[model samples]
Target: MSDNPAADAVLNLVKQQHDVLEKMLNNVSQAGEAQRKAAMGSLERFLSAHEAAEEAYLEQATKNLENMQGWVEKLTELDYTSSDFVTRFGEFQKELINHTQTEIQHTIPKALRDMTQAQIDLVQSAFERVSETAEPVE
Candidate 1:
């Protein structure tokens, strides 16, 4: 598949957050109380930041598209505050992976093929901001 640098970057951003979430879950499972607490705190930040970026781009952009509004609704319905939030986050992350792949594979090329570099930069920078100082999982 031809690369859409902007979309690929967005996929990477979400993947990074998913990786962070996985690491947090694993750390919590293996660590003492303090460590688990710390890990969960970090996970919270990663999850929140990633969600923000995703909403700003993927969700917002796709909301008006046919067959994609469902995803928007799903995103809203997901409960990020449940006790099972970690595992649920994993599920949500997988959904996002699917969404990213769809965007890169089909949607991005179709929707953003003619978009300007400035638009791409705006999206990229939005994702990158979440990389820095996104609150800890707490």
Candidate 2:
């Protein structure tokens, strides 16, 4: 939606983050007891870092942080093996994916509409700064 190529590039980066998050969620969901904790930690760290990048660069795209955090908290309290956990985690994944898509499709573009070139560059710079540090170790 943004006319600026820089904004478009940032949107692409954001989409890549969503792709990574989706993979991480799948990893956590499929992880065995021996690996679930570490997998979840990596997912949580990436989620936190992704949110931080958005908050720092594009506040309008992060309106659901509190809601997402609530889901994270609820999931943390239940056993991963429980049926309820699976059900709720599925719902959480759906919501998070929806939120990310919305940001990519509408929110970030709308925010970029009002910004100058310099501001857009700043957003790109700031987002990369936070996001690069949160990349998971393979």
Candidate 3:
């Protein structure tokens, strides 16, 4: 799990979206026209919700990362060779790598394997809520 709760929630939601997409694809492959149409409709809703939620989540995460990187740049401007500066930079780098690995390898796969139905439903609800209020793109 990430230290960031928002990131964890977003990741779980993304995993759920992928699962829904896969199921919809299977329905497309094996179901009759009526069933396929129903599945496609569900897919459209899920995709709209997923995209809105992911955009909001990622926008925040990117802003946070940018702020951190700006701090790192400030540190470099101060004294890149100082022991304290080097140590802080190393810590930041390590944290960035760990965060990446955890999201890619652990959190995502674990969400798929371990999330309960209720948890999945909660994420879906969150997505729907976001989608409902999001402004339409021109």
Predicted model with the maximum lDDT: 2
Q: What are the Cα lDDT values of the candidates? A: 0.55, 0.80, 0.49
Ranking by lDDT: 2, 1, 3
What lDDT does model 2 reach? 0.80
Query: RMSD of candidate 3 to the true fold?
Result: 17.1
Q: How do the residues 1-116 of candidate 2 rate in per-residue lDDT, one tens digit apiece? A: 45679988778777878888899888877877678777877888888888877777677766767788889899889887677877888899899889888888888888888888
lDDT of 1 by residue, 1-138 (tens): 336767566556655655555555565445554454555556555656655665665544445333334443453454434445445545645554565566555654554455576776776787688776665432
Q: Which stretches of candidate 2 lie over 4 Å from their true place?
A: none
**What is the per-residue lDDT of model 3 for residues 45-91, given as tens digits with 9 covering 90 to 100?**
55455544534434433433444446445544644335564456456
Candidate 1 residue spans exceeding 4 A from truth: 60-116, 134-138
- The C-alpha RMSD in Å for every predicted model, in order, reads 6.3, 1.9, 17.1
Clashing pairs in 3: none
- Model 1 TM-score is 0.53
- Model 2, C-alpha of 49: deviation from truth (Å): 0.9
